[model samples]
Target: MSAPTYIYKLVSFSSPVPDPLPEKLPLSELDVASGFIHMSTPLQVPRTLKRFFAEDPRIYILRVKYSTVEKNIKWEDSKGEVPGEVGAEGMFAHIYNRGLGTTEIESVAIWERNRDWDEPLKKAESWLVY
Candidate 1:
């Protein structure tokens, strides 16, 4: 028998907004929960590959990055913090759908494998996402 193979998948989500916004819109509490469900996976790889190749596969590392602007409010006047009134206005508009806010999602997956299985499987799993 040959050494096992490894596979990895990553997925990310962001708020709906455009560039130039100080920050991406905050995800609703519900949206955060939904995002996890959006990242489900089903086992479909052939048994020859999954059972023999993936069993005891090497450990892999994955990382995901997401960015969005957050509304900040403070009593004291500060350049960094958004004014309370403006924050309130934007929040109200966001809730009412006056416009959509924006966020950016990025993800990466990394793993080390025996040279024999590295090239082909890496290419195949490169674009895999949940």
Candidate 2:
């Protein structure tokens, strides 16, 4: 299948996301320590939640227009922190050189992490801008 036109971001914070999100999102702890913002494709979001956010009650999902942030994104291998870890074996998008901006986001949604995290992502195509 062709690559998606958008990339997705799952954040584990409780504050309501500001409209038009801040030009430079306060980088997550990992993102700050690593010096890059971590992002995934639509199909990768659910697994990401299950692997890294299972304990969180809810997470925010950001649908980012790929072309808008293409210059800053790098596709790199993520072989988990160790091995045999779920959701950490593919090439993921990492934003470097600058912080993510609203100009690149198409929309933002919240997912209540539960037994059904993967349901909405099954309709990933519908999340495309057009």
Candidate 3:
């Protein structure tokens, strides 16, 4: 399959992955509890961070392609995606598979709260990969 342009994963220091990165990273406890791996687009990161990652000291953003997850990824409408609505359109991308690895990740950068957190990733393609 052709790789997706990009998808985003939010991570903290404790977020699971092995040193030097891994070919396959394990899902977090939160992922198992929710039954899907939650990922955001550039359009969704601001709200995602506010709702799920508020006030966190460090947030790492990882860019990945859909080909890495296409076998088990699903695009579904979110129930509360638009508020006061029962079902929304293609509002979220979820991983139906098991885990993701560093090889699947294209680029990664540290998002410090002091920097452009105001815009909070205006565009998924805007970050400088390190």
- TM-score per prediction, in order, is 0.17, 0.77, 0.72
Q: What is the C-alpha lDDT of each candidate?
A: 0.27, 0.69, 0.63
Work out how many backbone clashes candidate 2 has.
0
Candidate 3 RMSD to the correct structure: 5.4
- For candidate 1, write residues 1-130 as lDDT tens digits: 1111222122122222223443333444543543311111212222223433453333322211211211211211122233333222221101212112222233233333454434535565534432
Candidate that beats the other on TM-score, 1 or 2, i.e. the better one: 2
Better of 2 and 3 by TM-score: 2
* Off by more than 4 A, model 2: 79-89, 119-125, 128-130
Residues 21-114, model 3: lDDT tens digits: 7777777777778788877665666777777777776687777775667677666554313322111234666777567777678867666565
In terms of lDDT, model 1 sits at 0.27
Name the runs in model 3 displaced over 4 angstroms: 1-4, 16-19, 78-90, 119-125, 128-130
Candidate 2: lDDT of 52?
Answer: 86
Worst 10 residues of 3 by lDDT: 80-89
| Residue-level lDDT for 123 in candidate 3 | 47
Which pairs clash in model 3? none
* Candidate 2 Cα deviation (angstroms), residue 16: 4.6
The true-versus-predicted C-alpha distance at residue 115 of model 1, in Å, is 42
- Cα lDDT tens digits, model 2, 1-130, are 3445888878885645677688757777788787778888766766787888777777788888877877876676553232222223476877777776676767888767556656545545576332
TM-score quality measure for candidate 2: 0.77
